[model samples]
Target: MKIFIAGAGAMGSRFGFMLHQAGNEVSLIDGWQDHINAIIENGLEVNYNGQEFNIQIPIYNQKDLDINSKAELIIVFTKAMQLDEMMKDLQPIISKETKILCLLNGLGHEDVIDKYLPAENIYLGNTVWTAGMTGPGKVKLFGTGALELQNIVPGFEKEANEIAEALSSAGLNAKYSDDIKFSVYQKACVNGTMNGLCTLLDGNMNEVGATSTSKTMIWKIMEEFRAVADFENINLDLDYIYDKILEFNDINKLGNHYPSMYQDLIINHRKTEIDYINGAISRKGTKYGIPTPYCDFLTDLIHAKEDLLDAK
Candidate 1:
């Protein structure tokens, strides 16, 4: 399969390398000049399981893209804020038969893609793996986890299954889920609780988990998320979700890992998916006349920090 990856940052580069190593034709589309040049000149440096390996794959900045290159699949790994513009820019390369898989965090990504592409061409999914870009052409794999995906439109299961099989073959642990939206929300809850807490505390997962204050705040955030999930009619058990997060914090899975949102704040980046996670809670709470003071407060706090950083 010819796979085109947009964003080509940590997760994107990792997926590109994985697919390429599995004997699939993969091309990366990214705007980062240094990253693109480094990968083209050298190769993508992947660090995983205490080992480092390099894989040579085609990398190009958006400006140099071949408008005519046909791809069987296009996996979007861009940050949520970039989704709209990236979808618009992808018009030149997308064909009718091309399947678009979005593994981005937050809700409303499918809406953004549908605005630019046909609904039938889109596939929705979420991932639990964590990765980060250390430097140009270098992506460190913090954790290897599973991906859950499904076709939102009817009659696309065969394509979705094919994509899942290819990812599984690459050792990605990809699976198809009929309840894709709920799965996305499940991961979003984890992100909402952990990501902002890590940012506020300036600590890794283990440190945050070890702190009484952080643990309490995580429970509060989960309560707010649970309310939102209930309002949205998404069937999620609060107990199950809470236990799952606590398990993840238990000195094994993500103990030393820094949440992605925390990394974004540290890098002085202007955007975050908090708007999708906690902000989603606040929005739905308002719509349903439910009190989400915790989410509302955290949303405002992150925005205030973002504003202060921007002012400086």
Candidate 2:
């Protein structure tokens, strides 16, 4: 399979590395110029399951992505806020038959993707894979994870399964889902609970879980997410999602490290996906006359932190 990983951050790099190792032709496109240059020069160094290997894969920054081949699959790992800009610039490779699998985190991404691609060409999914960027071209991949994907529009179940099978060939543990909206909201709950708190408290997942007041506060946020999800006709199992977010007993899942938002904001001084995660809930809640005080508050806090970093 010919695949392109758009927005090749930590998680994106994990997928790209695995797929390239699985014998697929993979190309990476990301906004991080240094990371792109480093990968192009030294290959992508991945520490997976305690063994490290450098896999040479082609990487392209925004100004350098010249493609003559049509991508069969463009797995989007781009930030929710950057979707529009990415699509406009990615016009060169988006053929009519190209299928876009959005593995990006957060909510309301479908609407953004829909603006550029037809419903038939869009695939929606969520991944529980965890990876950390140790440097520009390197990542620490501990343990393993799974992927769940489904077609964005009805009647494309066959194609969705094909996408899953293609990813599964690369040891991605891919599975086809009947209702991807449930998975999206479920993962959003995890991000909403841990990502913001970790960023605000300057802590890792375990540290956030250790906070005595964490569970109750996280429950309130999940409840707000549940309400907003309900308004959209997506039913999320709040208790199940909450337990998954607080799964710190195992280091492989939701432990030992800061969530992506913390890495984005505090560590790298980059803006976060808060507006599409918690802020999406708040916006939808406002639209439906539902109160999402916690979501709104956290959104404000993250933006303030961004502004603070800018001032520094």
Candidate 3:
């Protein structure tokens, strides 16, 4: 597979490194200059399951990418808010035969991708795979997770499954899904609960889940997310989803991993994906005439945090 990982952040780095190690010709493009230069100077250093190693993978910034180059598979890993810009930057590498696998978090991303690429070329999916940034070009990856994917255009199951098989060959644990949108909503529930609360509390998933206050917040947020999802005709098992998110905290699934929002606002002082996550729920809640006070407040709170970072 001639693979190009667009956005190449934590999860993108993980996928590109894994696929490249599996003998696929993989290249990467990212907006972060620090990360790009780090990888260019010294291969991406990955610490997986307690073993640390490096793979000399080719990476480039948007300015440096070769426009005439083409890709067989282009996996989008951009933050929800960054998708439009990323897709535009990645356009030159996309050909008619290009299969775009978007494992980005949050709802309503396929619509955005649709604007930039052919609908038939798009693959909508989600993953439980988690990775954390340790430095500019280094990441810590642990635990086991699977990739579940589906073709955005209906009646393309065989084509979607072929991509899954290719990813599975690289140990991505890929599976073709008949209902990936459902999986995506389910995954969003996990993110909405853990990412917001964990970031606000400045704690790891375990640390936050240990608090009664956090549990109460999780319930409120899930209920609001449930109502909004229900309006969209996505039926999520509320109790199962809530408990599943907490299970990561209870057992240290990510092992003291502070959710990405925390790293973005607090550590790097960058903006977050709040507008697409909880903020998206709040917007839909408004459209459906359902009250999502909890989500609304959290969205405001995250924005305030962002403002505070900027002020500092």
Q: Any idea how many clashes model 2 has?
A: 0
Task: List runs of model 2 lying over 4 Å from the truth.
Answer: 248-253
Residues 1-312, candidate 1: write the lDDT tens digits. 899999898889888988888899999988778888999888998887668999888887776666568778999998788888777777777888888999998776898899877898899999987787777898888666899899989888888888899899998899988889999888888888888778777788788888868767877888887777887788777788778777777677778777777767766363677788888788988999989888888888887777766721
lDDT of 3 at 182: 91
Per-candidate RMSD, Å: 1.8, 1.5, 1.4
lDDT of 1: 0.83
Model 2 alpha-carbon miss at residue 177, Å: 0.5
Q: Is candidate 1 or candidate 2 better by TM-score?
A: 2
Model 1 superposed RMSD (Cα): 1.8
- For candidate 3, the 10 contiguous residues with the lowest summed lDDT are 246-255
Candidates sorted on lDDT, descending? 2, 3, 1
Ten-residue stretch with the least lDDT total in model 1: 262-271
Please provide, for model 2 over 180-203, each residue's C-alpha lDDT reduced to its tens digit, 9 standing for 90 to 100: 889888998888988999999998
TM-score, per-candidate, Cα-based: 0.94, 0.96, 0.97
Identify the candidate with maximal lDDT.
Answer: 2
Off by over 4 Å in 1: 268-270
Report the lDDT tens digits of candidate 3 across residue range 18-83: 898899999988989999989989989999989989989988887666756799999999888889
